[model samples]
Target: MNQTYHVYILASARNGTLYTGVTGDLAQRMWQHRNGKGAKFASKYGVHRLVHAEAFTNVNDAIAREKAIKKWRRAWKLELIERGNPQWLDLYDRLNG
Candidate 1:
């Protein structure tokens, strides 16, 4: 199988809106969002800025993390992103094109 590691969150813009998800292909995922084809929630709400992500050894863990984040309060979710990425720069930039 293709290798991948992701539990991620995206915001519309600085604090505009938020989304939580899991995906193996971070770059492709972000590209889809950038093009407004990622998900209904992302396209409608404009949650396309990859503000946060976590790595896992496998999909199980990534899914668990995604579930955990889904249960978090919006403020807590914001805190998670603020802890590592105060500026919330598009993390996709860290990856090669």
Candidate 2:
């Protein structure tokens, strides 16, 4: 069966510290981050807000995208997020709705 992967960026707040990651399940990953059970960096930096997410059918592509985003300049990352999420809203709720 085909699978979906996600490349996501989490932030502490608008323009705050950021965390980039790739996951097969966005909602579950975000839940872990929110509950301080995800990445150490994210929990330690309070970066649990899902600011941006991109879907991919291929896991390798998603991983590559995550790696690329992680190396992006802060301004570039913000621009990417703002293009899709102008207000930098937490997208976790949207996942359920």
Candidate 3:
């Protein structure tokens, strides 16, 4: 079976600032974010780390998930990031490599 997922996240440089987004290609999308070429939010806010992501079976579910996460509070978002990416590493390299 082929499953598709849409995810949302908050990215910041070293400490704070959050950026939310959804993407079908997580690895490539994250690479662009890290390189400062993915989105204006990332470049402007220096949110270049893969702090959070979620997988969905459909794009609609992904969009829904993204919107849901976007509404979460900063602390909740931080917990979300830590849940999947405790160290807050750029998961793009591992996926691409």
Candidate 4:
């Protein structure tokens, strides 16, 4: 089966701390973040709300996007998230449900 990769952003709250990452399983990754078992930066800042995500069939593309976003200015990153999630909603429940 073909695997999907995702570049995702997590936030502590609306307009709060942010974390960017790439994952093969978004659902599982979000679970780890929520449980305090994901990236140390995220856990340390309580950045567990899924605010933005993009899926790619190619892992390389996903990784590239993730790296690019990680390097983006905070305002740019916020704009990216707000374009799709203006409310900065936690997308975790939406992904699972």
Candidate 5:
């Protein structure tokens, strides 16, 4: 079986703090973030709203994408999220629903 990995972006709100990460389980990771059990930066900044995500079959690819996004300018990152999620919705509920 092929395992899936995801590169995801979370935000405190529209035009608020942003976070990028890679995970094999997006839903579980989102759960962790929502509950304040994920990355220290996420918890510290209250960055728990899922704004964007991309899936990959390879973990390395996902990690690479995550790194690339992390290096992006804030405007670029916001554009990325706005392109797909203009409302900046919390996608975590969609993951499980």
Candidate 6:
């Protein structure tokens, strides 16, 4: 089976605290974040809503994209999210559906 990699962004709310990360299993990672068992930054900042995500075939590319997004200005990050998720809705349920 081919492994899928993802570059994802989580937010506390619309235009709220944001966290960028990379993972092989997006559902599991989002579960951790929502349960406060994910990144310290995410838990501390209450950033659990899945606002943006991009799938990658390469883990290295996912990691690099995550790093780049993390380093981006807040405006750019928000723009990225808004491009796909205009309302900044939690995408967890959609992942399964």
Candidate 2 Cα RMSD after full superposition onto the native fold (Å): 0.7
TM-score between candidate 2 and the true structure? 0.97
- Tell me the tens digit of each residue's lDDT in model 2 across 1-89: 78899999999999899999999999999999999899999999999999899999999899999999888899999999999999999
* Per-model lDDT: 0.88, 0.94, 0.76, 0.93, 0.94, 0.92
Model 6: pairs clashing at backbone N, Cα or C within 3 Å? none
Tell me the tens digit of each residue's lDDT in model 6 across 1-91. 8899999999899989988999999999999988889999999989899999999999999999999988999999999999999988889
TM-score of each: 0.91, 0.97, 0.81, 0.97, 0.97, 0.96
Better of 4 and 5 by lDDT: 5
> What is every candidate's alpha-carbon RMSD to the true fold?
1.6, 0.7, 2.0, 0.7, 0.7, 0.8
Clashes of each: 0, 0, 1, 0, 0, 0
Q: What lDDT does model 5 reach?
A: 0.94
- Which residue runs does candidate 4 get wrong by more than 4 Å? none
lDDT of 4 by residue, 1-97 (tens): 8999999999999999999999999999998988989999999999999999999999999998999998999999999999999988888889867
Better of 1 and 4 by lDDT: 4
Candidate 2 or 4, higher lDDT?
Answer: 2
lDDT value, residue 48 of candidate 4: 93
Give lDDT tens digits, candidate 3, residues 9-59: 656754488888888878777778878778897788887766666777788
Pairs that collide, model 4 = none
